[model samples]
Target: MTVVLALEKVTKSFGPVEVLHGVDLALHTGEVHALIGENGAGKSTIMKILGGYLAPTTGRVLLDGAPVTYHSGPEGEAQGVVVIHQEFNLAADLTVAGNIFLGREITRGLGLDHAAMRAATAELLARLDTSIRPEALIRDLSVPDRQMVEIAKALSRKARVLIMDEPSAALTHREVEALYAQVDRLRAEGVALMFCSHRLDEVSRLADRITVLRDGSVVQRSLRGEMTEDGMAAAMVGRELTDIFPPKDTTTGETLLEVRGLNVQNLVKDVSLTLHKGEVLGIAGLVGSGRTELAEGIVGLRPATGEIRIGGRQVQIRSPRDARAAGLAYLTEDRKEAGLLLDKNLPVNLTLSALDMWGFRIDPKREKAEMTRARKEFDIRAASDEMRTGALSGGNQQKLLLAKTMLTGPEIVIIDEPTRGIDIGTKQQIYHFVRALARQGKAVIVISSELPEVIGLSDRVLVMRMGRIAGEVEGAAITEENIVRLAMGLDREEEPA
Candidate 1:
């Protein structure tokens, strides 16, 4: 293997705080190097340095066996290094072709070569087996499609060293398969790949070498077949995690939320479910299986035709506000866009959801008090209470969002992808919080793509397929095998009665 890029004893700091210390890594051509770490363990910081978005305080970056410096991200790209950020970077209002060609448009005569750009964009997307139109505005595409656009943009750069941050976080099983094929092709082409993901299974499958980071230092590195998922996780967190999930709540109370024959237009159809106080109901399914749409229907985020009963009384919920008034709160899966106002301060984002309680007037003192309480109670780790929500780490932003949802004082809470993109440590904290909510007699509904998460956290699990409930598993019967079978529409034998 030939080294394409190498970081030797890199140390990075922000102001007076040092986040990374003496970290060393190397990316080899035709190989995928997996970088694993808990949130705030300096994974993103290292990536920033590698992609030329940040400069290391100390140590050297070597390109092709010689020390090199990149003055800017574009400079690094010019040197055959490119990064696909975890967050979507496409301009929502621009067409897919326009976004892919932005700042590097093909020119014909005196104007942009729109035809050539569109043709190139189509070719790139087609290579990934995606059907997204080059002329489609990014804002109109789904989350998975938007992610494909990001990948296509990266592909257009003709990168020799590609750094992908959580590339499959928003993709479905089928989409992931397509991505895997693309990765294999890139590997065969001798491109060096640095893959970062919280999903340990993906690392196990794709990485030729695995590097585990803990507290900003490299704790372990192993070649393929040298480490298991459990070993990788233990290394990343620096502990043997015995139980990832908290003990399930055994008690049940009166039914707090009931949906009968709910339909969300063409997305979800005739879904019926019930949630009781002191219960954590898990919704599990493949992406595009309508699990999210069903939740949106129940929470009035999407228009629906059905009966929604809160506290055994049927109610009309025309919008999210109506659902909130009916004692229901929804935490969306896409926290960056729908859940948090990233540009605002913590106090503002924390109180925005429950502003009705403040009488429609801004109260700085009251808001500050609430923010202080939330930061302490939710274990939100940030530089200060005044820090912008966008500036906080992914895990802390999730904590603040959870805290914000709780501030509404709803009796029923529906949290979708409660811990997606969160590290194992933060995931444990979230699980604890959800269990605590159930113990307090609040009806909780958790929807997740990770099967282990669904089985670990829920007292009962509902599997959806195509637009309807496929099956239900309860108590000790809730297992990954059972859930996957149901999700894939496989036949299962009846248990001995």
Candidate 2:
């Protein structure tokens, strides 16, 4: 393998805070280098330097063994290095073709070559095994399709060095397999790939070499064969990860939330379940299986018809406010979009959910005090409470969202994808927090795509298939095989005849 891009003793600083410290990495042609780290561990900083979005405060970046500097992302792309950001970079108002060729349109004679751009976009999408129309507006596309658009855009640059951050975070299992196939094709073409993901299994399968970062410094770098998932996790967190999940609770109290015949329009249908105080009920299903839809319906985020009983008394929850008044709260899966006001300060976002608690005339002193307490309690890492919510890393942002949800003081809490895109260490922390909530007698519902996460954290697991409960597993019966069988509609318990 030939070295294509190399960072020698790189150190990056934002103002006075140094995030990347004396780091060194090399990307070889035809090799996938997996970058593993907890949020705030300096992975993003290093990626920014590599993508030319930021210049390293010290150290040198060498391309083809010669030192070089790129003044901007476009300059880096023009030189055969392209970055696919974790967040979607497409303009929502533009068509797929427009986004793919934005600022680099292929002009034939004079005006913008619309037909050429659309045809080229079609070819890229076809290569990625997607059927999205190039003429479709980005705002109308699903999350998965938007991700495909991002990939197609990157492919359009004819990149020699590709940097992908959490590329599979929003993809379904089938979609991920497709992405893996694309990665293999890219590698075969001798592209140097820097793949960053919190999914260790992905790193294990796709990487030729692995680099681990801890506390803004390189901790370990080794061949893929030299490290197991457990070893990599331990290295990234600097501790032996024993019992990643807390002990399951067996002493559940009386049922706190009960839903019968719940229907969320076309999304969820006739789903029934019960959650008890001191219990973490897990919901597991494939994409579009109505797991999130059911939770949204129960918490009034979506219009639904159902019999919702709180403490055995029937209640009507028509809106989020109504649900809150009924002692119920929901943490949406897309925390960056729906859950947190990213542009706002920490104090503002933290208190937004519980504004009624302080009345109409908001008290800045009380808000600041509450923000301080939540930050301490949730272990939200930030430079200061006044920092923008978007400035925090994914894990810390998730912690802040969780803190905001808990501030509503709901007796029943429903969290969707609690640790999606978060690192292993932060995931352990969230698992403990969920169990602690149950121990405090709050009924908890965890909806996740990761079967292991659902099984490890929940007292009982409910599998959904096509908008309804397929089966329930508990105790020793909640294995991956059983959950998959239930989710795929291959197995179901017989009803009393």
- The sequence of per-residue lDDT tens digits that candidate 2 reaches over residues 118-186 is 999999988888779999999988777888899889988889999999999888887888889989999
Q: Model 2's lDDT to the true fold?
A: 0.91
Cα lDDT for residue 99, model 2? 98
Task: Give the Cα error of residue 226 in candidate 2, in Å.
Answer: 0.5
**Backbone clashes counted, model 2:** 0
**Among all candidates shown, the one with the greatest TM-score:** 2
Q: Write the per-residue lDDT of candidate 1 for residues 33-65, one digit (tens) a residue.
A: 999999888888888899998899999899999
lDDT of 1 at 308: 91
Write down the worst ten-residue block by lDDT for model 1: 241-250
